[model samples]
Target: MPLRPSRDVFITCAVTGAGDTTGRSDKVPVTPEEIAAAAIEAAKAGAAIAHIHVRDPETGKPSRDLGLYREVVRLVAASGVDVVLNLTAGAGGDLVLGSPEAPLPPDPAGTDMAGAEERLAHVAELRPEICTLDCGTMNFGEGDYVMTNTPAMLKAMAARIRELGVRPEIEIFDTGHLVLAKWLKDQGLIEDPVMVQLCMGIPWGAPDDVATLSALVQNLPDDWIFSAFSIGRNQLPYAALALAAGGNIRVGLEDNIWLAKGVLATNGDLVRRAVQIAEGVGSRVLSPAEVRAKLKLERRW
Candidate 1:
């Protein structure tokens, strides 16, 4: 298939993910107001979409509290920022095992498993334009924790999201995940013009090398709309590579922190830098409206 010429590309800033990184950086937003403000800042900095994940207000830890999500969404909606809201439905699935000898039992400190409905409560109520659906189960990292996404769970979530008229941003961490995503499509769980995010550079998943990225890209269905990004130092560079590979780009504090070798990054800084990179490659950055049209997303209240 012939590659599409560079046109306006959309940039999604994953503002704050459900990770335990709040202690690592004070810039990470904990309160709903802060998350909304950070998202607004990112929108002003040229982010077409803001992928959000709420944190616990008191402990600064990841939480699946629906009220917190509601507050964040309300604040963002009231902020008057022209950015697409992409809430995460990928939390509450971490399953950390005790040890190699006792893998049947889960580790208390790491396990945070919940039912699919419970996991997606925020997305269901908020009705964001886009929500992530992790494609399959995988070892999250060297730690005992495993990112659990059973076939049944994925199907249930996808069906519910479709019913709510929310687009599911299929999160593909490896080639196998893409296979599962395709299967979901074949099973009529996912709708036409499916959106996917090629997550790279995480441990126990596909490495952040050209060969791996190219292979993953090649394996994707011709009609699938996809974007790609790597974590840490390679985040900006991956923006260029993803565009060159005929895909979109994603970047933000959720994936990386350093603006440079030693400089800590704000979400806006990362977004502004990504915009510069995309424009440098002769591709105009898409606005929130453009992204909505391209992705066939429905804006919610």
Candidate 2:
């Protein structure tokens, strides 16, 4: 891909991530209602898609509770927001090793492993417009915790997600994950207009650098749709890079909590800033309906 800058770009706001950022930012939405409100706020601020991950109301920890997801979806629908809903199917694959030497039984407190069906329980019932499919397993971050997404596990999840008539946004954490995504497409697990999220700047994942992002963008299939993002301070800068690289952008508290140096940001603030960045560079911000048509997504109201 030879610097094919996208004149028209869409924004995906990751309302709340499954990270331990609640303690760091007061704007991180924990409850289902709060998460839904955040999504709505982002939508109103010009985000075409709302990437969501629910958290436990009381503990402020990431959760896979179906009821919580349902409430969030219900609230978003009732609000009549036009943003496309993208629920996370990346949970339920956590594994924390007991110790460096004693790594037999994983730590029970953090391990939440489950089969394909169980991991996507909420998607089956709620049937959002889009859901994520993590393409590979990785040592997610510091410590013994690993985000496990084996080949067999990914295949199973992809097949099920396809059967549900939901679009799976293949998450590319590393270069090899792109290979798995291609393999999934070859296996007929992923269909047309294959969507991917180029996750960058995590501890163990792909680096957030110009060369790295360019390499990943070049490797993407010609017709595939993609959105790129980098976490933390590099996030806002990556939004512009993504647009210039012929890709869409992702932002929100999920990736970064700061709007500026020492300034905390809400979901709405982040989306507004992304819109400014997009428009300032002569790229038009796409709406939810435009994204739906571009991706050929089915609106499940």
Candidate 3:
């Protein structure tokens, strides 16, 4: 497919990811109040959506606690921000196997696997406008850790999200994952105007390169609404790349923490930078209302 540049683009600010990034940067929001504030700040800075992942308040580790998610959602909604909320349903899928020497039993402390329904507990309760659905399982990170999302799990999760009238942002980490997303659509598990996120440049997932991104885009269904993002240093560059490729953009501390070398960034700062890139390229930055209307999202508060 040829590159199709969009004149109007919507930016999604991923507030705080579930990575072990809190120790590396103090700007990562650890508490519900902090996460909510960061999301609201991003909205004010022109992010159409805020993608959130809650962390343990004291230890700053990834957490899937319902109460924590509830508190964060409540605070953000109460703040009266116009940004669409996108909570992470990609948690609770960590699978850290034992060392190669002893690979029979998985490491209990490292493993965080759960049923599909358990993973979407927060989504079911809070009913955010958007939630993510990782399309495939792969060898994630170094060592034996795998991001497990089996076919059955995804089907069940997709059905539940559709029932709840929440849009599932199908996160495709590689070409095969994109293929699986199309299959799911054929099965009628996903709704019309399907939303997808081409997650590039993760350690074991797709690489951050032009050829790879172009191939991914070529495989996308014509009717789907898509966005693309890259992690770390590639985050800023991909903002314009996605827009130029006829897709939306995503940025924030979740993907990259550095605004420049040795400088950490806040979620708001990342959103502001993305705004400059989109507007610099003659594309208008879209608001939450515009995104919701474009995507046909239901804002269930």
Q: Could you say which candidate leads in TM-score?
A: 2
RMSD of 2: 0.8
Model 1 clash pairs?
none
Model 3 local distance difference test score: 0.91
**lDDT for each residue of candidate 2 in 238-293, tens digit (9 for 90 to 100):** 99999989999999998899999999999999999999999999999998889999
Model 1 C-alpha lDDT per residue in residues 99-201, reported as the tens digit of each score: 9988877987778888888888888788899999999899976778899999989988888888888899999998899889988999898987889999999
Model-by-model lDDT, in order?
Answer: 0.88, 0.94, 0.91
Q: Model 3: per-residue lDDT, tens digit, 1-301?
A: 4768989899999999988889889999999999999999999999999999999999999999999999999998898887899999999889899999998699998799999889999998899999999999988888899999988888888899999889999999988899889888999999988999999999889998999999988888788889999999989999999998899999988889999889899998999999999999999998899999998997765
Runs in model 3 deviating more than 4 A are none
lDDT of 1: 0.88
Task: Show pairs that collide, candidate 2.
Answer: none
Cα misplacement distance, residue 202 of candidate 3 (Å): 0.7
Sort the candidates on lDDT, descending order: 2, 3, 1
Position 68, candidate 1: lDDT = 89
Q: For model 3, state the Cα shift of residue 212 in Å.
A: 0.5
List candidate 1 stretches off by more than 4 Å: 1-5
Best candidate (score: lDDT): 2
